[model samples]
Target: MEAMPHDPAKPEFTPLDVPPGGLETPYGILYRPLASGLQILVLFAAFIGGPAFAWVIGQVPGDLSQTARDVLFVPMVAIFFLGYGLWIARLNAIAFHGIGLGLLKALFKLIVFRRKPESVADFIPSRDKLLEMMVRAQQAGSSFAPVGWLVGVIAGLTAMLFDSALHPAKLFLLVGGGCVIWAHLLAWLGRRNWLPFMESE
Candidate 1:
């Protein structure tokens, strides 16, 4: 034992294997990468776009008295949920239980995406086309992610209209359900034509 040599460079050499049904970042509990990345983008757009949109909401020079915060935050939350569910589909290699865990993790981390500079920074690298390919390899739904964001924005606005009586519950039910249904629909439509090589290992 006393004669054992230490290798500083190889410190602990941990394998980068995601657990059978779990995920962790060096920072701690994370979702599958593509989903994580999409959530991060939604977070990024929200923080960057939220305040400005909020200001516009207040300044539109009309009877519209709503705060800019709602204008920004609603879409942010909506898209995040949609993106999150589709992201879960990517991890289908994992058990359904694991996917649920991943989805829950994504929901929990929703707030984490709000922490400034870091949030914005995360989105920048995800713009790489190669990164999308990598995400696809993992079975994450990159194809519909953009459309998911659009659908999320629409759903968010719709929720806002019904907010007075519905509050947050409506948003959750509608957005979450829509994401699941649309994702499955898209998957089905693409099934016949989808290139199998695009699937993950």
Candidate 2:
């Protein structure tokens, strides 16, 4: 009889097949390219649009003092960030039930009490521990970024209020440097999956 090649006694196990469209979560559909593109577009629009709008408004005639413009501009920037965050949360919620409302409530609680839910899984995942961690980390970073900006703005503005003699060039450099640092930090976090909205394939 011809020798036969021995076959393995057991077949190797394969991982559970993911759905063709990838996983769905309460926050949104977790598809790759589309999700990534939408997130980039939204973030870019908000960041750029905020400053541009502020500049346009500042140019309008009113003889508004520079301090007043600075104050107004800071709030406008904050509003852009807030609006974008809420809109994206809502868009994600449309895929799953109550996620938008839940997110808003949770955000309010966190802001008011500096308290987080006992478990993020309660919001992002019912069963997947890994996914829960990913979502929570991203959400935390997202929340922190705006707060950090706000803190910087408030401090800068407070100093300007007390001493209007602060050099404009120095102030511009400080703010610009801080913004550059923030952008780089956010980019790093996004690469590490810390920024959920900025996550890509």
Q: In terms of lDDT, which candidate is strongest?
A: 2
Segments in model 2 whose C-alpha atoms lie over 4 Å from true places:
1-34, 56-61, 65-127, 144-201
lDDT of 2 by residue, 20-94 (tens): 554566643333323656656655754665466555544443454687556545644654455346435533544
lDDT against the true structure, each candidate: 0.42, 0.47
Lowest-sum lDDT 10-residue window in model 2: 192-201
Q: How accurate is candidate 2 locally (lDDT)?
A: 0.47
- TM-scores for every candidate against the unseen true structure: 0.29, 0.32
* Clashes (N, CA, C under 3 Å) per candidate: 3, 0
Model 1 shows how many backbone clashes? 3
Q: Give the TM-score of candidate 2.
A: 0.32
Task: Report the Cα lDDT for residue 189, model 1.
Answer: 25
- Determine the backbone clash count of candidate 2: 0
